[model samples]
Every structure is written in C-alpha cells, then in structure tokens.
Target chain A: MELKVYVDRLSQPSRAIVIFCKVNKIDFEEVGIELLKGQHLTPEFKEINPMGKVPAIVVDGKFKLFESHAILIFLASAFPGVADHWYPADLYRRAEIHSILDWHHSNLRHGSSFTYFPFPHELCSDETNVFQLNASSAGFIQNTLLAPLFGRSLNPQAAAEAEKVLSSSLSKIEALWLKESGQFLLGSSQPSIADLCLVCEIMQLEFADETDRNRILGPHKKIQQWIEDTKSATKPHFDEVHQTLFAAKVKLQMQRK
Target chain B: MELKVYVDRLSQPSRAIVIFCKVNKIDFEEVGIELLKGQHLTPEFKEINPMGKVPAIVVDGKFKLFESHAILIFLASAFPGVADHWYPADLYRRAEIHSILDWHHSNLRHGSSFTYFPFPHELCSDETNVFQLNASSAGFIQNTLLAPLFGRSLNPQAAAEAEKVLSSSLSKIEALWLKESGQFLLGSSQPSIADLCLVCEIMQLEFADETDRNRILGPHKKIQQWIEDTKSATKPHFDEVHQTLFAAKVKLQMQRK
Candidate 1:
C-alpha cells in the first residue's frame, strides 16, 4: 500500500504538507478531515491520530505519525533524491532550518490565535451562535471564559491584545529571520518546508477582515515579499491547495451579511 | 576549531544539550551565558544569539545555531556514527520522535511556567535577582499581565489552572506515548533525544513546591517510571548536568525562609 496522508486544506500545516507532496511529486492519497465539520474529532479519525489534529499520515497502511514539521522532515529525509534544499544534508544549513521550524510553533504560528479569536463562539445556550460555525480554526481555542464575552462582532480589547501579540511575533521574524539573506528564510534560493510552514501561516490572515489583515501584515515588506516568493516557487500547487481559504473567506463574508 | 556551546545549566533545554554532548562525547567548549546576571541580555552575547536564549552552539566557532531541539538533531545528524537510535535512519521512528519533540514545545514544556511563577523578579532587584539571575528562562515569558497577577506567592487560582494544563499534557504522554512496549517512549528500550527533551522538562518540576508537583504528577505512574528509565539510560551525564537544578532548589529554599 502507498503512503496515505490525511489533511484539511483549511489548516495551514495541512496546506504545507499538501504543497510539499505535490511539489516533490511524492505519490500519496489525500484524505481530508474537515476540522470545521468536526470530522477530526470523530472516533474513527481518533484511531489514526489520537490528538485529533491534522497533517497526520499512515505509512504502508500501518505506521502512524503527526505534527506537520515532523512529517515534512520525514518526507524530505525519506525522499532525499527529490530535493536537497528542502532539507539539506549540509549540517549547518539543516541546523538553521531545524531552529526556525522549532521556533515556528510558539512564534509565527501564533497567527492561529491572532486570527481565530475576536470571533464569537457559542454565545449562549439558547441562541445558537452562528459565528461559532462560521469562524475557522481560531474559534476552536476553547476559551470558555472569554466565549460569552465575545458576541457576533470582534471584541475590541481582545482584538487589540491579539494584534499586539501578532505584531511582536512578526517584528521578530522581520528582524531575526530576514537578516540572513536572499528570497527565503535562511537565505536559501529554494523555499524549504520551513518557508512553506510559515508562509501558510501568514496565508491564514486571508480569513480576517482586510483591515485586520493589513494591520497585522502591513509593516513587514520582507515577509510580504517572502510570501510572494514562496508562492512563485511552489507554483500552481500553492494556489490550488489554498482554494479552500478563498472559499472560507467568501463564506465568512456571506455570513457577515 | 571545536564546537562551542553556550548554556546555563539551570535552564532545562541547556541541561539537555549538555547531557547530549557529554553522552555522545562530542568535543566542545561550554560557554555559560549567565542569565541570572543578565549576561545573555548583554550586547556582546546578543551577537551570538539575537534571541538572547541559551543552549545555542557556535559550530566550529563560526556558524551559530539555537533552539535545543534543533541543536540535538544537529548533533545526531552531524555525527550519525555515535549512535543510530538517537535519531535513527528508519523513517517511521524518526517521524514519531519528531512528533513528540514538536508537541513538547507547547505541552510538556509548560512545566517551566508552573515552576517559575511563584518567585519575584526583584526579590533583591538591587542585588540582580541571582535566583532570578540564575533562572535563565522563566523571565523570557513576556506575559506581564499574568506575571503581576501571580504575585510572589503561588496564586491558588493560577496554580490550580497551571495544574490543570500540566495534568492534561501529562495524561496525553501516559496515554499515547507510554503505550509503546519499550522502557522509553516508543518502547525502543534505548532512550532517544525525544526522551531527553521531555524528561528534562519534567525534571524542572524539582523547583515547584513538592505538594504542587505531586498534585500534578501523582496519577501518572507510567510517566514517572519513564522519567527514571530515561535517567538511567543517560547515566552519569543526566545526574551530573542536573546538579545545577539541585543547587538552584537550595537557593530557592533559602529565599523561602
């Protein structure tokens, strides 16, 4: 049996995984576990990934694995002939890539929180919160304390707080990551999985209102260009996989009306 | 030139890096970045690691790298002849290890927050807060709102909340990781760096009040044993490197009096 990869294009990590597979031409079956539909939470999917998260895979129909960064490394390592720059053997280059990927978890990936919150969850038991269903991954934050406080519209205080957190994180990226060189992180000519991992995260801002998105991304010219560079490098696969994001944006817009 | 590693052993990630180098017999110089004294914050050291964090290495005195997980992987990948199990060639095993390490950044590593919050940053602000000085990391968290709220003593509300977060993280370890047959995580019999990264995090709980630590750790028998098993596998390096933890505990006790 061929390797089977489970993902939802709605997820940033999942989009990275799909693009990596497609760019590298790694043959595998794509299994979509729609997070908004609560598909990942099902008992059946739990057998594949107990954590109920996405970007998980089954190798040869038996071995199971999760975590998008790990999966990216595994694919690159397992299929070395496909591309060296993605995860190069040069020890220092690989180490630099490793450093960024590890840091991405708490840092740049905070985009998940910045974009997710400010939207409503179940506002009250009696009133089925339409925003909860309409909101994407950030709504899954499980902050029961703040859920009731945020009604249909964005919570101003929470939105400001989220923007602060996101801005600091972005500033660090612009200051620390971009300093090295070139079109991508670590100054590499080709965009590595690290590039994919982070660019996909920045791509999530598309779900937010244009004003909020601009507020978060506007200052960082390098990051904006890096995203474009990553897009061009990945080609049709990048736009194709992110089609779901456009769809979500349209749906969220319709709900706003 | 030999590899130069910057560390302050009081930091858990630094301790793990020290232990990895010692066990692997990787020749290097250990440059202690005195966090307690605000050494890492200095302009000179900032040149080495812009993040101002420890457990960074200057490979061959030129190429600099940070983040302990990445450093550990670098050592394993760079010097594969030392031991295969540290980071094996088998794709699935490596993937599983990668999964655990990534999960660790957010989950198991939360112990740092739980253990460190009760201490004041300026117990003797004039004297440089050496315990705070020696404490290389906990200060790195910029949650000023939560910091003031925690006060000098363990806030019951915060401690209870911390316990809830920690217990949930540990339960996942017991349920998902310990299920494998070996003594270590994944039941491989040999402890991997994934084992080192996590066990080191748990070991930091040595700083927490015994009551609070026990409250959080009590139910997880398998995890406790795994900690011991990881210690035994790593042997002298684990104990020797962790001596700093014991000394810090003594200092914290003195402050309590």
Candidate 2:
C-alpha cells in the first residue's frame, strides 16, 4: 500500500505533512477528514488510531504511527533526500533538533493549541459536563501545578486563581516569537519542526477571526516569516475542499479578534 | 573519557537513566545537581544546558543531549545489546513504543511532575511569575486536547482540566496495566520502551507519601502490582542514593504520622 495520510489541510500538522510530501515528491494519497464534522470519529479511523485523532497514517502496510513529531521522523527517514533542514541526521545535530522539537511540541504546540481553540468549553455540552471537563483540567493545573510552584499546598479555589493567570500568558509566547530574530524560528534558516508547530497553532488563531497577528506572534519577525513560508510552500497540498474551510472560517469575525 | 551525567536522584528521569546505566554496567561519572538547592540554576550547569534542567549528559566531550526519551534511545543504540526493551528493532512495534513515550513525555510527565513538585508556583515567587512559568501548558491541554476528544472546539480550559483528570486517570492507566497483564507492562516475556516510561513515572508514585498516594495514585491494586514489578526488576539498577531518597521520604512521613 502506498503511504496514506488521513488529514484535514486546515490542521497545521496535517498541512505541514501534506506540504512536506509534495515538496519532497514523496508518493502518497491524501484522505481529507473534516475534523469538526467528526470524520475522524468513525470506527475505521479509530482502528487506525485508538485516540481517534488526526495526522495519522499507514506506511506501505507496514509502519503506522500517530503524534506529528514521530510521523515527521518516520517520513523523513523513509522519503530520503528531502530538505535536510527538515530533519538533519548528524547525531549531535539531530539531538539538537530533537531537543528543540521536544520543547516546541510542549510549549509552542500546546501554547497556540490552548489559546486558539480551547477544548473544555466546547466538549462539555452541559453545565455539569462543563464543570467536570473544565474543572478537572483547571483543578490539576492550579491545585497540582501552580500551588506547588507558589509553595501553597493544594486548595479548592486555586483553579479559579490559575484561570486568571492562564488568561494572560499568551503575550509571553508572542514575546518569544519576537525574541528570535530569524525569518523562520530556530534561526533565519528554513522552517523546522519548531516552525511547523507554531504555524499550525497560529493558524488556529487566524481561523478564529482573531487575526491580531502582532498581538500573538507579530512581535516575532521569524514567526511572521514562517507564516509567509508556509503559505507559499504548501499551497498545492491543499485541495479545493480544505481551501473552502479556511475561507469559511476567515469570513466571520470571531472572538480574540 | 567516560560519560558524565548531571543528575539529582529525586528527579524521575535522572533516576531512570541512572538505573539504566547501572543495570547495563555502562561506565559513567555522576555530577549531582542538587535541585532543591538550585544547583541546576548555577552558571556552570547553564553552560551544559541553557534550560538548566537535570538529566543532561556529555559523551566523549562532544555530544550533549537532553530529553529523557532521546537519551534512553541514544544510550540503547550506542551500547547495542545492552538492553532490548529500551527500543525494539521492529519499526512498527517501535512506533507503538514511541506513541506511548511521546504521550508520557507530554502529559503524564507533566501531571506527575507538577503533582510532585508544583514548580511554577514555588519557583515563580508570585502570581505573575506562576502564570509566566506554567499557565500555558494547563491552558493548552484544556482547550486543545480535551475539547477535540469530545468533538468540540477548544476553549482555554484543557490545560487545567487535563491536570485534574490526571488524579482520576490513574484508574485508566491501571486498566492499561491490567490490559497488558504481565510482570512488565507490555508482557512478562520482555520489557519495552513502555516499561521505561511507566517505570520512571510509577516509581515516583511508589515512593510518594501515603498521604500523597491517596491524594493521587491511592495504592490502587493494579498500580501497586506494577510498582512491585518495577522495583524487583529495577533493583539491579537502583543506586544507593535513590535507596536513601526513598527511605528518607518514607521516614519523614513516619515522623509526621
């Protein structure tokens, strides 16, 4: 079987993978899943990934994997002769790349992920569900995370306090984008996994109708460059369907605007 | 020159590496970065890793890498046959291992780490600092992760919610442990990278105070069994320092009781 990637181009990692395949001429089939429409929730996709998440794939009926970074390495190694900067192979350099990738996976990936498309408020359909869903994560971060950091033992009301603080952390991320002076993050060099993580996240922001590029990532010259790079580099990977989705999203003036 | 590992036995990843090296009989020098005393923050350690994190190593005076999973792989591959469970040769199987490890690194690692230490609150010294240190992570899980699973859009909640569910997620993890049904997590037949991840994270709970245990893992039978297995299998790799760390923690608890 040829490599089959079930993805929605609107998703950043999905877009990056689609583009990486095209740029390197890696043979593959693009299967679009309207993520919001619950396409990935099908029994078929669940068989592929128990998590029922996207950016999943099967390779030559052999190696199958999820998690974007894992996929990135697997594909890069399999494809061969793609841009070396996408993932360099020297042991030391590769380790450096992995370190940066790990940091990006958690920070940039989670940073933009939480800000643009918050999960709890949407997942919980009712007040009880909302309280449980939101309260669970909120409780953990504040009671378990923030309380320890502040040297205060866990408290029942701590999550509310944390919610206040979490609301303001976005600008720190924008500041990071500004601090790095490259056109693409991790330097003026070509976009690495770091760039991919960030682009995907900020794309969520743009989709949300909150296009304050400067407020989020505008201060960072390199992040802005990455947006430009991704836009130009990955056009063909997007089919008419995916393009329509983005157009529909940008049409509305969403919150965080 | 032998490898040099900067570590403090209290940290899970550092202890795991120490165990791995000792069990394999790999030669190495130990440089303790007393985390409580902020030795890791000193200028000398910063030169080794800008993040000033523990569990970094310098090999042959050249390759310097961070990230526990990356380090485990590098060591296993570097010293072939030292251990089979660290990573397997089967690409597909290895991919499964990677999925688990990656998730552990991003989620379980944070949940357990924060519950144990709550670094952001303690270290940041104030509300602004706490937000500056860690709110983004809480928010990301809330908005990006939790919402997606339920077929909803993300809100600024997954981070905290994800953390809260962690206390309960232990049961889910126990189900996984039960599902595996073996001495090691994957099987009694052999260990896998899954074991490495579980062993490290679970070790923290095993050594955690009974009060903390009830607060989190709660001596749940499945969790207890897995902990027992890890201890028996990992004893060969256990350092005297860790033995004392465990003993001291338990002893301190006894005094309080």
Candidate 3:
C-alpha cells in the first residue's frame, strides 16, 4: 500500500506521525504543508483534508484520513511490522491508551499552543474562512516564541494561562500515568502512541526561552524523564523528524539574541 | 461480567455513555457523581478515575477505565451483543470514527461548556487542587444557562466568544461530517459512538433559553435534522437518558419565568 503522509514538522502531531512512520519502517512519502507560509490554507491541500490541517494521510491514493491520533492508530493497526506495544492488541490495554489520547486532546493538547490561539474573527467566519487562523498565532509557544517571530506583541495574561494549563497537564501525566518503574507513560516498558503524541507536544516548549521553558517544565521531573525515554526509544527517527523544529528553535533563539 | 458506570447526567460525555449503554442493552449499574455537589472530587471516586471526571467504569470489580470515548470503545468491543454499526470492525472505518471522536474533544467539546469555563486560579493550583473548578461556570451552556443556576451573573463577553467557537464547531460538523444522503454523521446508515458523543454534547444547549439556542443552532439545518435522526434511530433510550437534561432545561426555564 502506498501511503502519502502530509505533515508540517513545526506542528507537534505532524512530527509524531513522521517519527512513528520512521521508527516502524512504514514506507511512506512525506508531503510538507508549511503552516507559517499559509500553505495549509491552499485549495489544493483542502481536497486532501477539508479541515485544511497538516498530519493528514492518503492511503494507496484512495482512502484519506486526518487527525494525528487517528492516523497513528490506523498506522499501528494496519501496518504489519509495527510493534504491538505502540498500540497494544489486547482490548483493555488499548482502551487505557485511548483514554490517555482522548484526555490529551481535551486537556493537554487544548492547553498547549494548538487550541489556545486567539482568532477572534475565525470564531464567527463562514465555512470557507472558518478556522483558517493558524494555531501558532497566540498560544503559549506563540506568546513566548512565535509572537516575536511573527512581529506580534506577547499577551502575558494569555501566556500565563496557557502555561498553567500545560503545566497541569504535565502534572497529570506525572501523577496519573507515569509509574514508579516504567520509563514510558502508563508504566509500559515500550512507548505507546500516546507517549509520542504528548511528548512531541511538550517538546514544542523548546522554542521558548530557556528560562521560561525551565520555569514551566521544571516541576514535572517524571515527565522530563519520560520525554527522554520516548526520545531514546524512538532513536534517530525522533531526533530526525524533530530536526525542523529544533532548527526553528535555534533560529528563534538567535533572533532573540 | 459485571459493569459499574460512575457518572453525572449533567456532564455531556457521562450522558453519552449512559445513553449508549441503554440503547445497546448493555447490563450496567449506573452510579451518579454529581458535579455541582463536587462529588467527583472525593477520594473514593479518585480511586476509580484519577482525573476526577465522570463517565468512568469498572468491569467485574477489577478493571477500571475513564474517558467516555475510550469507555465507549471498550464497551463496544468487549460486549458481545453490541451492533457493528456503533463501532465498525473495519480498521479504516474505525479510524474514521476515531478522527471524528478526537476532533470532537478538541473542537466541539472544547468550545462547548466543558473547557471554555474560566477557572482563573485552577491554572496554577497544585495537583491536589487542580481542575476542581466545575465546567458549568463560563462556557456556552454555563454562560447562557447554568451561571444563573449557581447565582453567578452571566458574562456576556465570554458567552459571545464561546458562542462564536461553538457555532464554528457546528458549522464544521455540518460542512465536513454531515452528508446530504445520510441521516447519521460520516454518511452512515447507522449511528456510531461519534454521533452519540457529539449529539449528546449539542444536546446540552437545550438548557439555554429558546431564543439563545435557536439563534445559535438555527443556522445549521443539517445538524438539526441529524440530531433528530440520531434520536429516532436510538429510539426510547435516547430520550430516556436525556430526560434529566431536559428536565433541568425545563427547571432553568421556569426559574427565568
């Protein structure tokens, strides 16, 4: 099956999907949709994902799918060589992972830079124009990093609020999911898609100034270790896919300096 | 196998799970954890769900699970008699449903009464006290309805903002998911858990005044029909499970009168 993966590495979920594909050795073609340049808003990209978001996939040029978590599940279940631990086959264990994934969407992911972005007009825009607002506009990452990159003023109140949500999400991961022994979330020996998705989300904080990032992430020791563990388990692919994001971080830092 | 469901009918996902079980003829005992009373915050409930949210379940007195989408998936997969239409066996079809489910959590659900609730200090609270703020404080439903229930004055600005987000979410559902040919979401002949979860979420808007609800929901004609179709397909159980919500709506209306 020919799988065409549409992604923008700057987007957290996009990076997770790329890393998953690479680690699992899934044969796929990567098509970039740059969010910063408004590439994702093009009419051509709309056909692939009417949502006009990145981290979409087209399978064998027939079936199309969006939403990174769903794509990850599809890849894990459909691919033959993907290790079972990535998405376990046992019904109960799989359900637990689903809980985490869903929680992440509403809780951690929402609190992150993704949904917290303020797009006042998009809220009331027509179908053609709705949600055209990029997520990188006004969230935690944007407030700390992207705001400067885009020549926008930081909203300190919004940033503080987003940080609280993100920190609470991290604390939940540490207290509820992280085990005393296991390196990965849900206390599993191997990292699951939830780990990759959430860690990749937290990794975006790297774009923030070192002081700000540390202040936000410093309290979550278990989460810190889990990120390292997830990065290690995924190997070169994790760092490889994140190269774009890290490069962006360095560029942003240099600009700040 | 024995199943115990802990829920509060006031919570959207909790109602969805209850309705799903009732419609599917799943034998499960319902345990109420009232949100207004802050019952979910108790330590006993925390044992069942560390997140302290509702619609959690325990199977045969051993296995525990939370998050409505995950619980629905578990129930659909684990139960013998559940129809395939609710959650299809095909991997691709299932992934499509997952896409919708995840999208609902971040979009419709977030913009609704759940996440938009402003909990100022909860943002910085420790793990022991985090997220204790109830959802029915400052969202579309809360701002339009429940704010008065707790004697809290409505914040018109926040309500208008939430309405914009909620309306945009509804527009996306109408534009992207609902089809001209089918009565159910994703153009399916039968209702899926995605339909149940999302419909239940929209159903909460019934609490708002008639004019406010109409002004918001009136624009989305297809969504209106689809809600009715889903209700019809699910038969008595749909209305049965929603009786509490509808009753609350009537009471809130009477209070206004």
Which consecutive 10 residues in model 3 chain A have the weakest lDDT in total?
A123-132
Per-residue accuracy of model 2 over A1-257 as CA lDDT, tens digit each: 38988776656667667767776788889887766566666788767665556678888775567777677777776666677777665655566666665555444444343222222233211101111223333442334333443355665464444333333333433443335565654453565554555465456545332343344454455456557775565555434324644664554334213
> Across residues B1-257, which tens digit of lDDT does each residue of candidate 1 receive?
47899888877788888999889888889998766676777788778888667768887778898888998998888875569888877877888999999888755554244435234443311111213322112322213122443453324444454455567888998899888888888878888899998888778778766675686678989989998988888888899999988887777667656
- Fraction of the reference Cα-Cα interface contacts (below 8 Å) that each candidate reproduces: 0.93, 0.36, 0.86
| Local distance difference test scores for all models | 0.71, 0.56, 0.76
lDDT of 1 by residue, A118-143 (tens): 33333211001112322212222223
> Judged by TM-score relative to the true structure, which candidate is superior, 2 or 3?
3
Question: List-wise, what DockQ does each model earn?
Answer: 0.53, 0.30, 0.58
TM-score (2 decimals) of chain A in model 1: 0.85
Residue A146 local lDDT, model 1:
32
Per-residue alpha-carbon lDDT of candidate 2 for residues B4-36, written as tens digits (9 for 90 to 100) = 888777677777778888777788998888766
Model 1: per-residue Cα lDDT at residue A125: 10
Q: Write the per-residue lDDT of candidate 3 for residues A199-242, one digit (tens) a residue.
A: 98878676667787788888878888888989999999999888
- In terms of docking quality, how is candidate 3 classified? medium
